[model samples]
Target: MAAKPGQCTERPKSVPGRTAVLPWRLAPGIALFAAVALSMIFAGSMLGLAISRPWLGLGLSPFAPVAKLQDEGALWLTAVEGPAARAGIPPEPARILSIAPLGPGAAGGAVLLTGADIMEEPDVLPSHAGMAAYFARQNQLAGLMAEPVELHIAALEEAGSDTPPPTAVYRITPERRRPLTSLPAAFWMQIGVGLSGFWIGVWIWTLRRGDWAARFLAVAGTGLMASAFPAAVYSTRELALPDPLFWALSSLNATGSLTFGVGMIGLFLIYPRRLVRNQFLFVPALVLGLWRLADMLEWIDGPALGRHLAILTAMGAIIVLVGLQFRATKGDPRDRAALTWLGLAVIIGAGAFVTTVILPVALGVSAVVSQGQAFLFFLLIYGGMALGVARYRLFQLDEWAFRILFYVTGVLLLLVLDAILIVTVIDERAPAFALSLLVVALLWLPLRDMLGRLVLRRREPQRGALFRQVMDVALTPPGHDQRAIWAALLEGLFQPLTLSPLENATQSSITDEGAGLVVGGVGGLPAYRLDFADQGRKLFAPADVALADELRAMLTNALESRAAYEKGVAEERLRIARDIHDNIGVQLMGALHSLEPRRKDQLIRETLTDLRDIVNNASNPELSFDEMLADLRAQISEHVFAAGMRMEWVVEGGDSVILPLANAHTLRSVVREAVQNALKHADAGLVRIVIRQGDDAIFARVEDDGKGFDISADYRGNGLENMRARIIALGGDLSMISGAGGTRIEARFPFGAERRRR
Candidate 1:
């Protein structure tokens, strides 16, 4: 709908596509993303709490000796309570050799915990799993005990024989459980990693709405949160959990693993360029999803075989896709560079996880790192992805790094200031906070701006100053000197590491994966290359290309204007030459032919004087208006006397100002021509010249009291024509009146206009 004449309809505002805020079209997704993200974080924290809580809601718990901790593979009694602790068992490092139920349901089996069984381990599953399973089953059996249990405890070589001997046997009923105190660092670490990945994905997605790469990255982030959040609960369990609950958490973990595999696979297949069709991505998804489902249902024998296999297969597919992308991106340095960094992340991050956690579990050995610690390796994945995004944006490395540095510094400084004010000095929170803000504003912010400019070292030349430099370069006569000025100006702007002659390339571009900035010739300056911006600290970005183009445009315009001005100067010199030939040449020849010495001498002197005046007027600087007016009077009187006519020169006004030297020659020539014409052809006995000066302008007239011819008649002589043209060229006017009265020629000059004076 159109608005009425006086009404206005405002367009909606949206965040730019380059930054973090979502555009209007994509803003609706933020709510969904936030809801899901908040729920996931909350759920993860609760799950951690659930793992440490008392099972079955009993005040007294079972499993007096907590065994087979995740930290050390060997059984260590992390905690002991109830009958076991009362019976002289210490809360110290001790191995649980075996646990045998003494009542009903006990005859079926004796669980051996933490040590190798006499029976050979299964070929498919690692021996480590056997020990872990025994621990879990023992904890479960003890918790469900109706009567009592006999536990065999063995001590390591270092355990002393004190209250408990090297080997002790205890028949005790377990009834105590330790209350939850706190969660481990690994728990919060998992949350932190998940949240970081999620936010990074959302940040990219919002900035680059509708991009398939960003969409897939968000999906990958979802997978990261999913896998890590659930694993944080199950992987860090203290003693034991019920069969149903244990399996349920494991199932979620497996699902998260499979989901992560699918997202990662899709990410590689589509990023940089879509390698496969959208529907084709479902092949990996379905296959991995089914594999994980089958693992959960016990269709697969070994623990996590399906999950590990799915991950390995996805990793393999990612390598193949990256290889294909490498070949496809040949000669496209930017895409190739981004691919290199992202590909390196997959190799380094996932490879570390596989080597430390997955492969070790498969090979029946202790992992190099704990499972929770293994998750930290994938931080490299998110970090690499972020780096790739920055590359695509074409940010100079130094500039990007400095922005991050200053941002972090600002945050830290503000925090420190707040701590100092609130904790040490100020008594009230409000005043302390206000003081902190003030300090940060006065100190940290200014420091950041100052340090940031120095670190980045990109001088964005002001438009006026840049114009002046470009004009300097343009005005220089074309050669080494002009090129030097151009190079100097570019140096101030870019501060490139090295300048080299561009051999063949002749266009403005960010070349060599941003390592080189090449500029084509402008204003006849030779093409040159600026390499490694900021003294080898950063790469040239796309923005630098635009800056170079602007400089070239400015220089081109300045050169054109200078060229036009030079053309005008040359034309003016040509006009002066014509006057010298047409007027002075005639007198010099007559003097050469004269037979009397006096007459020849007088003519020669007068000709020399006129020539001197013309030459001086052409090149002289502006003189005082009063001085110029007096000089004009004396010169005209001398001319009239020489022409054998009476002279009447009048002057008016007492104003003193600088006269216009730019066109003074033209003004003088115009008056001289009018006076000479009157004496030569007006048939006038007396030639009168009038001069009047006002504050803003000056008017002059030359007339004769004699018979006046028709001023409208066309003249072959150039005297009147030259007079009219000269006055008009000064941005003034000349008018002639002749009708049986003395011919009057008037000239007007608006010396007040500075533009006219210059």
Candidate 2:
């Protein structure tokens, strides 16, 4: 059976209660909005930490203490003491090092403290002074001190005569000190967060619009912006900015951070399934943004606003997300488990946030550590959100598990093979070679199976089975009752995998030897012939041609096969005839001539007659040129005698040429049939036979002067059938012309010398 083009089978329904909605629901939208808002708020707080550390209502001052001591001329204080004392230090004059303040109003200040002096009597030093001094240097002491003061301290234990002003001094007089003038770290972070949000919005919009390219662009932009902000702010805080380079870096970092966060969140929201439903979630993010603007305009401090807002927003987002999960599980039990898992991940992430951000802030831990912990929590939350939104667990669990197992097994196998190879072989490359062999051996069967299944899956399901069934039906043996065969075919094709048979279709014509069938369409209409031996028949559809054409082809193939067999038989007989003529014919003629007197004459005549008969019979195998002419003349004579008519036979150009038996048989049959027909139907009086040999063919004309009949109307049926078949089989032709007074039959057989032209 020949293969047909493949097709996809109809997929079976497996899951029930699955419905696709056109657009996102309001609840999911709001939840997603809240998530974005919270993310923005946290991101803003991170940015604030990267900026100036401001003390807002903490009562723990961020400014340093300045004591302006008015003393006699050229007097240097060894130490100064004040009432602001905690537990560690009290009236410690040696603790005073060097202080420099910017001009009179104290817009900027500088202080240098000696570690030796602080360590020597830290217990005696006032705690307030120590704390105030720490804050003053760090925060520039602009709001805390009113007058510039310089404190020059001389150590009591160190001699001052050869010392370069005791190596450190405090400046109490007001001296102008420049504040670090660069863009706030939070400003760049805000820009980054804003840009990330913008791009994320763009991506969401593109996704809604079904523009994949635009979505990708938006995603890329958001990713770049998301990473930029945090990186810039962090870098600025970590390194001293002497120029605009830090500010530029901050801007770039803010942009990058925003891009990253927005892209990641946007992808989560737009793809997979929605987890959030409240559009109002965007409100908190908008509030954080407004707070950032207010800080820029000096209307409010950003850190205070951002920190509180972020905490509230985070809590709100968690509540909304949890509510969404509950809603998602309400009607569909199938999605309940997934929703539960997602909700748990979200809760765990929120817990991490509280532990890292809120608790540490409440305990008054180091701001840097707290902020870092908060950022860690943010990372965890985003990671969990990404997983939930991408439905990574839903589709990837099996695949990931399989990959893990495969890798583990593969690695173990490789290690074992390597160890075995190393132990057995001394060659340096043996381990590698052995590992390669082992890997191939392990994978070969599985790879082959995978390829086979892939090929089968890709193929049209019905084509192969249909082809086999059709071929089996077409090639069923003749004389076996086609009714049963048709029933079998119908049964075989009635299954779900096979094509249904048309009603009333049956086998119309069986080949003569039962090799093939000519099937009929519905209602006994003839269809094409199908041969058991010929595979090409499968290329055509059964209904492509008329019934007559199929029947004609079948008959033609049968006749052609038979003709070939006959031709072979004729060739063998001609070989036998040639052997007899070369030996016995001459021997008989010589022996007859050698006999005595009347006996000699009679014997010679009889021997010649016997030889002629033998030669005639030998021509039946394949006639020589002279023998063929004689046969044509004999046929004409016999026909004329039977009709009681005078006959003339003439032969020309008979040479030492031998024709193939197949050609000779064809010529004889044409002449005999034509002459007999003329005698029976044409009613001829005088008959003439002429045999002529040309360079390319042997032409025989059998003419009769007779009352002729219409050639086309009267000359059909068995005689003409035999005549035409014989001539055609020998690669020759027969033509007849009969009219009013006479009839002529002509046969042309190209043989021997004549075949050279062909």
Candidate 3:
């Protein structure tokens, strides 16, 4: 735990709860699907009136009065003094009790229309602005755009106070509404918002159903889809639809908007931290839903109730989001990432709605964006919301979002300006196109680059520097400590609060087992364990694991390279040693024989000894202590005889002890040097060498009787200090005592010292 400022003893609490993100489940998916199905059913049944005949319409002027079926099975005039009235239909609204065919000669038969029957009509794609673009295209292709169709209709009016009710029948001839006349906007809009909202909701529920934010988004999406039904059922309306259908659609829209608001508010309350208990969060939504219901039933006047609730709820949500942003700024990077995307989307999406719809309506002016277009923009909000929930490319989205937003805004603005120029100045399509091209080339592209740079600076100014560090790591030459390099790379990338080896880590990437990341060793050992306990107070995400895997691969390559280089170096050293021994050593031996008989042979012997040492050192031969002792005794005997002196060599105990190649070599050198000094420099007639083993130590002594010297005065000149230093370096000891009687040199080494060093 990091020590907190001003407090030496207090420890920070662990993150309140472990985020147990689970695999997507089937149950939540099914429930989400059910919710959509139920919503569609309810919206389809409650929001529209449908009248079925061979065909139904009247060819009348724009001023024509239109009639519609009411909820109570009544024929009501939605418009007066128009087509219906001109066609000799009565102006008074009447209830239709029943209808019957006049005779076989009648063109068609009709009966009472009920709310249930209307509700039972199949749900159809939304139609608005023009004839549904697809249907219009189909009609135009089929040459039926202006074709006339005959529609049969009848009404059974309720009887007056004293008169019997009468039934009337009429034949109405009207041209089919051009199927494809309307733009395709409504079709695509409905599909876009409805399908995207539904599936995004399902996706959230399936992946993060227990998350408060996910649940809120799920509800919001479902509500948005349900509310969209009203706009979906009509296509390019030149006049009002029937009474029941119009009012029902209006009521449904209000209800759906309210529900959406509720979802928004719920989302605000739960995200980041729970402001209140989740148990009571739904109470506000329920109460508001009832208010919508009461208004729909005419129990209260709620003409602006839905709109007001929507505005209020939105304000509350925005306020909560601001608080979240403040908190997230100092919180987890993941939290900051999520809020960044969400904030960008809210700015763009809400700006569209507010500028084009809300502001215009508030100012009592026509909206720049049509109602159809306004609804389409809601898709943007849904898209952003989904991305935020999924945490897609969270750490990397900052610059990208800025670039995309800038580009989109720039394009839209340029297009608008180009249109203005074309209409007000040029009045030519060709000039408009050219101007658009020019704006993109001369202004937008360069501006995009500039904005990108600015955003990049704001986001990660050290990104380039970090990349350079990574490159340096990758390019580190072979023979360097690869493990140290790996450690440095990790520190740069993750800046882990604490790094430790994870126990029993088996996989290169692991989460649930409590290890943040585990990179396997070359031989399947748990080589590296990464902990993110203080990684911006966030858990390691899947993306972090992926990055670690990539780096680990790089580190593995570096290790392999270093190993290969060391092998090459060793091979080269052996080759050099072999060449020098085979050529120079033979020449030196020949010179020894050619020298004069009286000349000192010690020089040649030393030269040969040096060559042998080089060869031995390069080859790194391993031998047991007994074998090394035998070799040393043989060398000592040759040197003693050459110096005209005798050597009494003895070895006792430690027969089975094996020495490392280095220790064996050192022992050989030390024994050879001592015996030579006794025979040559000390001028001793006979030297006695003894080797003995104790319980935990090996002891060797070389004693000689010669011209005795003062121990301290001649030690440095005789290389006694050098020999002592070498023994001390091996964690052993060397002692020498020389006086008028003799000189004694002793060396003692802890048993298995070389093995312990390894």
Candidate 4:
């Protein structure tokens, strides 16, 4: 038997929530990803240190002809205690006619080199003379890493005035190894990009776990490490690596770059909005894989143009995919916002990558900077993606796109100007960059401000007009329409694309990641939902919610005050009606009993009946529609009988309906006046009365067969005007038509017309 749970020495082991992020039931763990990332970084660092350990003892660097105008014929050679330096090689600068290998394993067909060889361009057409010369020198010096190098030294001579310069051959034997601690600054930079990108990508991926975009970003990071580690060994070579090893490293770098582009393209295609199906996401990788194989096999113009062209193609695809996503993300402000930032990072990083690797090959020129340094830009891409997960959460914001776009435009413009000045005029980078900043500040900054004001900061509506509109809704009379005025007021302020009721909202707030706003209810009014601020051009922000809250509060207070005033007026009216009923009604009733003449008695009876109607209508809060119609039919029948005329009363369709006492009273007065006027003036033999309820309104018509009066003439004297006023006051329409036969009065009173207006 098991012991009581608390008393047991052994307890159940706790297991945290484990969700599979991979198909093989792999769960996300930070420590697991960290271990894998660190392992990769360590392996890459060791490989880079090992491959670059062998270095020629001489510390040679590229010599600029422009810097040393007097000695433009030779490259610089730093003084060092090495085989070539002790063999009487010039320590300052030396012009070499040709360098021949005493053995095999060096690059460039094992051919003779010359001073002119250092100055020659590689392509069929030359572009950027300085870059071309630097490339030639780098290629020539690479052979010096081999053993037993024979240098044909040229005597110091100037061009155009020199006879044949004396040349002598001197062979340098053996190669001294460089310590791992002496690795160049560029190697560390390359490794830093690799490790940072991988770890950041993994960290972000761990958060989202199963998100496709995050996974693709992690792939891009892996590509960064793969590309950078190999290029670090090759690009930073102090001397030549073996031909096979060099080729192998170059192929790996090409593979990694293309893979990076493929990953970026896939990320854009899936993130923010899925532009394509999951199965087709790997199409780009498949195509690039085939291209890489062809390049390695020397099938597509060999290494000269194959990898560069493939890289260019991948970039082109990414650009196209970005455009597609932009169109696909319409009507979704959140997706568009995320896309804007993500697109910026990918395009800028890819641009820098291609500029260093492929742009040099294009324009038929050599790279202006070391290609390994370009890996740093990929760090920016990784960092941005991590921030998307860690800080901004990618789709959580909608109004930041325009701001970032504006800043990026200004930054890229400054960079372009600075680069131009550096390449074309100023040799000092700091002064050139400072001058570029000053120029931009003077010229483009004003334009940027003007454009930003036009696009981002719209002028607000006048405060006076806004307040007046609010007052209009608050001051609306009890029987008149105010809902239309309220709706218009809100429309004039925010101009949201959609306005709907918000269920159970208690406070005004930005919602749906700034895609919408919810305003709380006030003064018995339900909450409202407003989406896509500025008519779908922008998203609702916190400032808009604050404004909504203030307006709602103001309107709520105004409505409450209005209610209080109406309450006071209603109470006073009730008191006056009571006094009139108690005091005036008894005296009038006594006067009617004392009358003797028939006409005077009839007048007194009518006055008493009118007083009774006024009291009853005022005291009752509501009246039934069917009851009112029945009472009217009976009264009309009796009046027609007393007048000795034929009566036709038709009623249809109001079995169970009710009306407010005020509306019922006004409608009753209008119909009675119309009947009375027809009997007294129309001189008709027969009268027809129709009272019917239509789908959305109540219709009443009274017609007489008598001498018709011309409607063109002024005809409002016979109680027509009073009837019209009564109908109009109740928010209904009144009409009259007089013909050769008789006159017809038709009135239309919509159901709940006054209710809606209120």
- Over the full model, what C-alpha lDDT does candidate 2 score relative to the true structure? 0.44
- Per-residue lDDT value at 316 in model 1: 80
Which stretches in model 2 have alpha-carbon errors above 4 Å? 1-110, 113-228, 231-288, 291-302, 331-334, 362-370, 385-758
- Of 2 and 4, the candidate ranking higher by TM-score: 4
Sorted by lDDT (best first), the order is 4, 1, 3, 2
> Each candidate: RMSD to true structure?
21.1, 30.2, 24.8, 18.6
Q: What tens-digit string does per-residue lDDT give for candidate 4 at 58-173?
A: 44444533353354434434443456666667664445455566756554433543333322112222322432344545555554544577766655555575586577777777
- Determine the C-alpha RMSD for candidate 1 after optimal superposition of all C-alphas: 21.1
Cα lDDT of model 3 by residue, 562-590, tens digit = 45755765786787677677766675766
Give Cα-based local distance difference scores for all models. Answer: 0.65, 0.44, 0.53, 0.65
Sequence-dependent TM-score of model 4: 0.47
Model 2 lDDT per residue over 665-736, tens place = 677777777778777877778778788888778898888888877666766653787787777766778887
**Lowest summed-lDDT stretch of 10 residues in model 4?**
3-12
Per-model TM-score on C-alpha atoms: 0.50, 0.26, 0.46, 0.47
What would you estimate as the lDDT of candidate 4? 0.65
Candidate 4 backbone clash number: 1
Return the lDDT, model 1, position 470: 81
Model 1 residue 435 lDDT?
84
